[model samples]
Target: MAVVFENDLDRDGRKRATASLMSQFQHAAGLCTIIGSFTFLFALVIGLIR
Candidate 1:
């Protein structure tokens, strides 16, 4: 339910919403880090080849 919306009027709902947002942020950060590392490695290889 928190994936799209957190439709609760209680404090737990707000807490869950924050948790979901943080999880999403963490996931995106991990993905970005992986891609950045791969790209860096690729550039390093190309530099060595040239």
Candidate 2:
């Protein structure tokens, strides 16, 4: 019983860590996508003006 309880706790900790890491990565990817799109639009506008 004690071993099972410890295993459960360890599993929970690992799951929480994985969730947080995934969220951080998702946030960074979103920021990069937004920046990339903005830059693309800016370049397009400049090209049209010229």
Candidate 3:
């Protein structure tokens, strides 16, 4: 979905599209970091209980 939307830019539109894609990428990266941190924390707690 993101890739499809990103590929439709005209010359002027290309700059906007690039910025939008960067914003999207940053958002996805942040979410992954948060999810990963919590996952590791939970796994550590589970291991300690065993």
Candidate 4:
């Protein structure tokens, strides 16, 4: 989704907008990865405890 939006901005010749969108998308992806890892670890710990 973010990639598609970024591509559209790039096609429109909005360099700054494309860069901003790419940065935001990267940040969001990083956050999601961190959260997902933590959640998986927490679930694993709970399962092990049981």
Candidate 5:
């Protein structure tokens, strides 16, 4: 148990942390892209209708 904990504390934990960071970054980027696209489309429609 201690060995497993130590391994996680050293290398494995770092990998997990990096993976989580990357996943969060991707999620944020996706959200931004979706929101930006929607806003752009909405503005375009509003402009055209006006």
Candidate 6:
């Protein structure tokens, strides 16, 4: 109970932080691409119907 705050400036933590950030960025990018494709397809279908 004496050591509640671990050191935050460690090598492993920094490496993990960067890796996590990169993966999260990629995830968001992929989601955006999927949504964009879906929206485009919906618009295309609607246009064709009209």
- How does model 1 score by TM-score? 0.70
lDDT of 6 by residue, 1-50 (tens): 12222234455555456555666677778889999999999999999999
Question: Which residues of candidate 6, in runs, are more than 4 Å off?
Answer: 1-15
Candidate 1 residue lDDT tens string, 1-50: 12444454455534466666777787788889999999999999999999
| Clash count of each predicted structure | 0, 0, 0, 0, 0, 0
Off by over 4 Å in 2: 1-15
Please give the TM-score that candidate 5 achieves against the real structure: 0.69
Stretch of 10 with least lDDT, candidate 4: 1-10
For model 4, the stretches where C-alpha displacement exceeds 4 angstroms are 1-15
Error of 6 at 31 (Å): 0.5
Better of 2 and 3 by lDDT: 3
Error of 5 at 24 (Å): 0.2
List ranges where model 3 is wrong by over 4 Å. 1-15
State model 5's lDDT.
0.67
TM-score each candidate.
0.70, 0.67, 0.70, 0.70, 0.69, 0.68
Scanning candidate 6 in windows of ten residues, the lowest lDDT window is 1-10
Candidate number with the higher TM-score (2 or 4): 4
Off by over 4 Å in 1: 1-15
TM-score of 2: 0.67
Model 1 residue 37 lDDT?
100
- Per-candidate RMSD, Å: 5.0, 11.4, 4.2, 5.1, 9.4, 9.8
Q: Kindly provide the TM-score of model 3 when superposed on the true structure, using C-alpha atoms.
A: 0.70
